[model samples]
Target: MRFSIYLNAQTPGPQEDVGIIQTLARQAVEATRAGFHGVVLTEHHFSGYNTYGDNFMFAAHLASQVPPGTKFSLAVAVPPLHNPMRLAQQCNLLDILTGGELIVGFAAGGSPLEYAGMGRDPGERHAQMAHNLEILEAALAKKPEDPPLEWETAFEHGTLHTRIMPSAFHRQSPAFARATQSDSGAEWAGKKGWYLFSAREKPQALAGRWRLYKQALRAAHAEEVVQDRLDWSMVQKQVYLADTSERAEAEIRERLVLMADNQRRSFGHVKDLRDAAHLKSVVGVSPQNPDEFLDHAMLIGDPASVREQIREYEAAGIRHMAMLFNFGFMTPETADRSMRLFIDEVLPAFTG
Candidate 1:
């Protein structure tokens, strides 16, 4: 039952691209002040679809600005494209800067171009990613009994034992493996005792994934795991609150339409497999009907109505609900307004 904001930094087409970094940081500060538990920044490259280029570096910069107790997480760090040792070093630095508030989720790079552009084969990405992750996990779990070295000095020493930098506050900050549309990824995560993040699209598909993950966990007798700490999350793409359903519909309709259109444009270009229904279901978005938008993918309405929708998700075993303050290319003013309204009316009900 925690609320976090996912900042895509969605900028409208052909705009100035002005004041974006500052504006996003300001939103993070606002979410902290508004009593949100955390903020997750998504990683995208060359797509022009998301604003964050390097999430770990940006996270390090933002971690300094978050109010007293807010958690900071780079929702998923693409592991296939990084050197395992250097990635570990950067993560350690971020962990220190954030005062141990970082939740690091590693992924096999989702953008095939991100790998192919680097002259890597997409087919071997997962195996390489698994190898890199093993090294990272071992480095994070470093102990006094681990390897030591002696570097040659003027006095003729051998080699230097490289110390793990910026020691984390916990033994190791929690890490998750990004689950795919299928349950195999979820099952792998459960086998490793890591967290799982879900997209709202195809709730039934994600539910099946969760079922396999749970089955794997029980079959393996996972350590330090019970039903409570399965630690799953789902992202809700839109939210709005108003005095009545009528006002809510009026304000949210235009934004949802733009959002749905954006999704269609983005996904239409994605090769291999077009499941419009899955995309529509997950985002809780539909181009055809705004009234029934709430039925599939949103929590827009009066306090009672919004809460009732959230209750269904909560009952579905989603421990964390990530909210996008402004979906599509909505103006920041509108997005901020929605956040304030949600804070005033809807957010309290869930936390309480």
Candidate 2:
């Protein structure tokens, strides 16, 4: 199983503005030294979610400083907000800098606020996202002879044939889609025969999504994905560790509450994640007690306990587990401690 920490400062508010870069860099160094596989940063726009919205840029900067073995990735990027050519170039450059360790997670720019902030119409985002994705894929594939560019033609007085820069890593790096809620991600992942890194904290929802993914793959006739393809990871994330179950419960409460509240506010108005009728249920399932959430969403507890949980997920076909242990007010110290505990105790039990 592969383990990676999702990098983000606990809270970016005035009270806790120590910044994630310093802590994340330190954590990355520790993770690499400790033998963890990778670190993934998330991208968000115009939200207090994380002060650092440019995940690709941040990942690149961090990648340069990380220890030798640790890799870096952007969990998801708002595709419509970026020019595909420029985005591809930047990603390629990052991949080169990281020695070909880059896994791109593309998304259709969630959050209407991000779209509104960018002056993009939310209704047209999916189509626009599809267009941008095609351009990016074509650029990465080095299909330069392919033409009929619409977005570029409108901007040019005449004709402009532009190819992205630093395309060296185009053939080396792989890409994935962040499947959130809808089957759009599975459908697209299958359509492109690309990998899908599906993340769900909820087991039931995750099972449903996994089924949907298989269905989509079957529909698209996607070939058996290669394990070497970083994008094709079967990742199931949780906020868990090994200790007495009672002790685990005591440790994760406050942090979970803060995280759930932040989530409720972040996507509060976004109907895609939660409908009016289902909003309370969403929060209800989002454990007010971090340990309870851990029992359900995270893979934390005693060694025997966590092992059993992992076995269930492995049975469900999850090979890579992206454990989200550091969230809310989780200090870098605690986060590091959790990683150590998981590595030393919980990790050994599951070698599948």
Local accuracy by lDDT, each model? 0.64, 0.62
Winner by TM-score? 2
Candidate 1 lDDT tens digits, 1-352: 7888877765555353455556777888888777888888777665445665688887877777877556665667777677665677788787777777667776654444344445454456567777667666766666656686332211123322555565676656444445454567778767766666655443455556677877777776645573633643444445777778778778778776775565556545544432322333322235456556655556677777877776766666666777777655666777777778778777788766
Number of clashes in model 2? 5
Q: Which segments of candidate 1 are over 4 A away from where they belong?
A: 13-18, 112-124, 141-163, 172-174, 202-228, 231-236, 241-298
Per-candidate TM-scores read 0.76, 0.78
- Per-residue lDDT over 1-352 for candidate 2, one digit per residue giving the tens place of the 0 to 100 score: 6667676555657555555556776776676566667878777676565656788877877777777556565767767788666777788887777777777777664555565566665666667777777667666665457673434411122222555566655463445555454566655565555656765445555566566666666666634553343324546465545368767656766567777687667655554532233333321335445545555556666667777776776666555666666666677777777777877777666532
Query: For each candidate, how many residue pairs have backbone atoms clashing (under 3 Å)?
Result: 8, 5
Candidate of highest lDDT: 1
